[model samples]
Target: MTAKLPAPITLTGRHVRLEPLGRAHVPDLFAAGGGDEEVWRWIPTPVPRTVEEMAAVVDARLADTACEPFAVVDRASGRAIGVTCYFDASAEDELLEIGGTWYARAVWRTAVNTEAKLLLLTHAFEDLGMGRVVWKTDHLNERSQNAIQRLGASYEGTFRRSRRRPDGSWRDSVYFSMLREEWPVAKARLTERLHAGAAVPA
Candidate 1:
């Protein structure tokens, strides 16, 4: 199985538009979610303390060939309130992991995450023709786990001590995935949930 790596593209939804992550978004992103430890808790990198640090982080993400990042812009505010990405892609395997996601507290209990994910998944399977889309979160992040499950991904199991966190703690990676065959049902459920203004725990 083979697939092309996702190219930079904008995925628009009712609540948000996922623009290709760029330097221009750092200011808005910083204003939106920067300096929030809670938002960066499960993230592997150091919590950015300033806009400059945020720019450095964004640059690092953009420099990585394996990462295709997006700035999650609020449709109403037109500000980048968060970031998400297709990470560690394997074109030869028709697989990629969706990781490195973070959002502002303002959008936490809203439909923003649900709609943003719908856009990404639609493009992953329908446009990129990917066979699988994966998500892995720290075992300690129950909210993230719940969010992934709510997206109709099946829990694959845990990988113990998969990596060390920025704080040097061993991270047990909890894995979930949605296969192409199962996408129709998941997509239907997600679309319905989106209409209901569902609050995702991601």
Candidate 2:
């Protein structure tokens, strides 16, 4: 018999739902991320300028074996607000990287983002038995870098001249990681922070 593949995983958190990418999500995802030039400022690929382009990008990602993207839905509103992926996965080494994440300005710096990330990291280290979970962003993306630090991941240094951006400029990649041993304290702190933030008045 063929070895069984892991069942399609759907991770639900308090604030967000992570569903495996599918054609059904294309329209919402396009609306959520398409035509947002600011979202793509630090990334290589241009934001999808049209629905068709968004669909094509999602299709390509679904077809790739090395990476799997999920549509991040805000449970409170039942709307897809962004995308995130487990890429450069190494099952043999029990490693995975979370990247390609982008959310709308409305949700940025909100409880939803923190809860969503808490869900992803918990699943990676606790549920999937990953030894280490990695995160990376453009070196110039101080916003993202700060978010990573806020999640309690250790900064692992930068890869200088890692890749060329769409604008023909070289980009440095900053890396961060949370090891299995660090998950307990990290998760507790993240949980406390999210819960505490939720109680604050606007």
Q: lDDT: which candidate is best?
A: 1
**Candidate 2 residue-wise lDDT, 51-97, digit = tens:** 99888878887877777788889898888888888887666788888
Q: What lDDT does candidate 1 reach at residue 38? A: 93
Q: For each candidate, give its TM-score against the true structure.
A: 0.95, 0.91
Task: Tally clashes: model 1.
Answer: 0
The residue pairs that clash in candidate 1, if any, are none
lDDT of 1 by residue, 119-166 (tens): 999998998778999999999999999999999999999999998999
lDDT of every predicted structure (CA atoms): 0.89, 0.81
